[model samples]
Target: MYTLYIANKNYSSWSLRPWIMMRELELLFEEKLMPFGNGSNWDSFRKFAPAGKVPCLHDGESVMWDSLAIIEYLADRHRGVWPEDAKAKIWARCAAAEMHSGFTNLRSTCPMHVGLRIRLKAISPELQAELDRLNELWCEGLNRFGGPFLAGEKFTAVDAFFAPVVFRIQTYGLSMNTQASAYVKRMLALPTMQQWQTEALREKWREQGHEKAVLAAGDVLEDKRMQP
Candidate 1:
């Protein structure tokens, strides 16, 4: 059995990537939740992950850190984690790579918080530019693939990679284009997504200094499609 070391499911966006992929693939594993930055055994996580980060994967003796690397590793070991078509594979790789490298502004500004929401004081000009670029990326993916997912009919690694971004867009109360909004809706409808949301709602750990920024009192939107 594989062992996945993750932070609180509520705020760990990177953690979600592999967890969702594993759930979607139906891979059985044990999950160890370590609250981010501080907790009872926070320092011990570094022994498992070189970078002292959560979302570390332990497969027997081998250890893989970083979300995208984990996804690629899993796909290498478990073939269908990503789509198999030649073109779909290429575009999926591109989408994942772009997400892995870009979006600094969005990430820095709108961190992922499961039970929290924060309205931005000012959507930075750079962040707005990044949003435009993301809109273009989503539009391109939708135009090429048509309906449902980024790479057309199937939800590939590309979708998994962008999944957190969808959450961030909503969490920060960010605006979206038609394609982006549609994609967010589709992601919200995933059973795995609803499962995560439900679990997050039940978690009680709260990181002190980060709480105000992460979870805003007024940002709770209407309960839409997530499973409870």
Candidate 2:
């Protein structure tokens, strides 16, 4: 049996990657949520997570850490986790890897928070550059691969990697071009993504560090998305 250990649904972008991939690919796995900053949970998480990070996957005796690593491991074991076509697969992997390593500015400036809505006081030039690159990348993939999803007609790991970006954009009310905005809407509409968002809303645990950073940047207003 495959088991996935994750952190808070509201704040852990890394955790969201593999969780969404497994769910969208219809892979059956036991989910273990470890709320970080909790002493007991952190200690328990360290027992399995090699880097002491969340989103670790346990497959029998093997423990896989890192979101991209876990996704690649599952893709090797199962079909449809990634695109089948060689060219499409290459582009998808490139995009996913880029997401894994790049976009530090966007990640630092606009953290993922499904449960909170914040209006950013400003978008720095660095963040704007990252957003522009992201929009271009998404547009290129959709145009090149002919997608309703990132890689093709069906959802793949590429989409899963960017799932948190969808939440980031929504939470901060960031703007993108027409195609990018449409893609974000499509991602938000996925049943698996919706499930994560609902669970995130129900989670009361907050990472004080993340909360402080977000509060310092912008005002936390009512969740307009939830308001009737």
Compared with the true structure, what per-residue lDDT tens digits does model 1 show for residues 9-41?
Answer: 777888998998898888999998887554445
Tens-digit lDDT track of model 2 for 69-89: 999899889999989999999
Task: For candidate 2, list the clashing residue pairs, or say none.
Answer: none
Q: Which residue runs does candidate 2 get wrong by more than 4 Å?
A: 38-42, 223-228
Best by TM-score: 2
**Span of ten consecutive residues with least summed lDDT in model 1:** 217-226
Q: What is the C-alpha RMSD of each candidate to the true structure, in Å?
A: 3.5, 2.4
Worst 10 residues of 2 by lDDT: 219-228
What overall lDDT goes with each candidate model? 0.80, 0.89
Best by lDDT: 2
